[model samples]
Target: MSTSQTEGLLQQLLQEATVVARLSGQAIISFAWLWPIRGVLYTLLHPHVILSVSRTLFTSLLTSAIIFTVLAFFTYLPQAAFLSIFTGPLGPILALLLVGAESVFLVTFFARALFLEPALSQVFDTTLVSRGQNSLVRDGKTKYASSTKKEGIEGALVRPFQALSRDGLMKYLLSLPLNFVPVIGTVAFLFINGQRGGPGWHTRYFQLKGWDSARRKRFIESRKAEYTAFGMATMLFTFIPLVGLVFSFTNTVGAALWAADIEARENLIESPRANAPNSPKTNEGDVRAKAE
Candidate 1:
């Protein structure tokens, strides 16, 4: 590898390391919510947690495999000569100059799919269930709350491979060599993103979960400083190598959980009146009080 390539590899490796550590940290914090074992065992063996990590890894492999196969065939194409312009230093440099097309595309797309879609579904479902329970489940005594592809392509197989597909790839592509900058800000931004995407993904989820714009905005404002601090730790971890890569995946999930917890706390803080037991009127009164 040339100097640039070597540096790129080191940066990439560090990015992966911190990503994993950040994920692990998030997971630990999530389990902490359950108290004692609820937090401990869930952190270790949660199926969704494991599946999320596996999915991230698999996505990386699939995208890479697709890119490689295409690149191999493209080199033989007659038009391939024109694409060589991207191979030299100028290509990556030019890529760096672009204001992160990859980040904008991947983060928005994946965040929408992973968090928003499901959240909307849940919201609708909860609404319907709540309505239904009012009528059916409780026989008018309780309120029923109830609620209820594409593609195309052509390419040197690899020409398309160069396309951005995921948040990781986007962040990776966006920062480019700028990540090697000696200044604290640039490097810090690059490293933290590896973990930031994860929490960011979750923030979207909370927003979808009935967190109105004002409430969501307030939570983000309150937590922004802490998130930045936590991200610094994540940046350092992602630089560790094999271990770091694993942590990166964990970091994404952990960050999401951490953000959710913060929002949860905020919600509780904003409304201190808890529902009283026994009489339905007490529950109704509590709800009224909460709204007030």
Candidate 2:
């Protein structure tokens, strides 16, 4: 993809990431399955390469610390007897691996927020409204119907049914087979669910703008190819070492920015251009446009 297109994808991914991060805070407090599952779903929804890197680092540290404490408790006795099973001399290695896997999961979670949910939200707009409005409302929306405010723990369990329905369940079940497929399979499964809740938010955003589901879906789907390409491009960043880590934060933002670009272009929404004021701009057209 061209630099502009790539940047656009990143923008979109980042915007979704903010939503993903907020939703994740809710998911973490709610269900056992929500964290990693939510993580993957968030990734699909957001998929900002650079931001994912920073988020991966921040979350990996936090998650690994939690994982290590839990594993340490279990592995301590076994290792003491020299019959160590899960965490012997291999503890550090395992910890590292777990953290790495977690980083990937975090990425997947964001992506889910970026892709799956918004599309489904468009499909299930009616259901989002029909599911009885709870007493609790999110910061922006008036009622449960207008916001992606999934009711806390109680709502989490029932919410899927109201929003997703049988067809969504079928699709989720069909995706279950992918979980068995070694490393990639696990990643795929994470990616699929990560897509949830997000599109609904997008739907709400569109509703605010007097847009409908079909219009929103058409706009997003048009950029699907670009989104995939953005993922592939960011895949390159993971290969680099220390510098990659530095870039990872920006890369994720870049991913979100890319998404924003798609939204802006398709919807005729105007976000601040990258070349705004002090920001560097090599794009001749952007610079010329700004100069004019």
Candidate 3:
């Protein structure tokens, strides 16, 4: 990334972190209301989360199992081996770090596949309604809601898995070894995993705007720096053990807030001539009256 891009990303990261922090209390309440029975019941009643879970469960479990197995094998390696670097006095610390990282990764990995779409749908609806925007679910048959009717939920859910299966799994597995590389390894893992998590959070935004896979891919690619920063912040927050669950919920809310901001910016850019105070149309009218 360029210097300006890096700065912009850092600024955005700070902004998002602030938003997440500010809204942490609200997030806790929301999560509590949705937890245990309510969340599952809502999913059962809605096509969004249900479809996402169905599409992602197999792949997510497979990927997670593979990762766990690899980690298990490495833990059994000889003391003189490379994996043993994180052993001895530093073993507990290293174990905690790995567990934190792994927990964040697995939770986010499954969440992106299963819950993100529904969460985004729910969040975007709430955002637009609050802003007085005309937000409709699929087919315009109903307002955006928990039970909004969305077409192609199956395809939408499957796409992420396909992408993950293609190469994302391999990259994730490879990143585990990086945790052994002292300071550099952890940083690298954060960035790499953050990149993986970024798109998932942004997926709902793209859906809200009715963007297709191609457009979504292009847009995310263009704004990679910004999303990486956002994801990195999220990954760090999720590393906080018990509190990570709260952060995870807050991250969804934060993602929605971020999407709302992006949507607002896009609107301004697209309608600049219409919304401008002194545009060519106004100027031409004034000139014609003066000529008359």
lDDT winner among the candidates? 3
Q: Which has the better lDDT: candidate 2, or candidate 3? A: 3
Off by over 4 Å in 2: 1-64, 67-179, 183-212, 227-252, 263-292
Q: Which of the numbered candidates is closest to the native, going by highest TM-score?
A: 3
Give lDDT per model, in order.
Answer: 0.38, 0.36, 0.49
Candidate 3 lDDT for residue 261? 50
Candidate 1 TM-score to native: 0.38
Once model 3 is optimally superposed onto the true structure by TM-score, how far is the C-alpha of residue 131 displaced, in angstroms? 4.9
For model 1, residues 1-292, the per-residue Cα lDDT tens digits are: 3677657756775765565445554544533322222222433664444353455555543443343344335432322233235444433332332223223333334433343233322322232232222111132111112211012212111011112235345445545544333344344454345334323423333423534458756765554434444554444443332233233344444444443344345445745343345423434533432332
Residue 170 displacement (Å), model 3: 3.3
TM per candidate: 0.38, 0.30, 0.54
Model 2 agreement with the true structure over 76-136: per-residue lDDT tens digits: 3443344224335644443333333333333333433344233333222222222211111
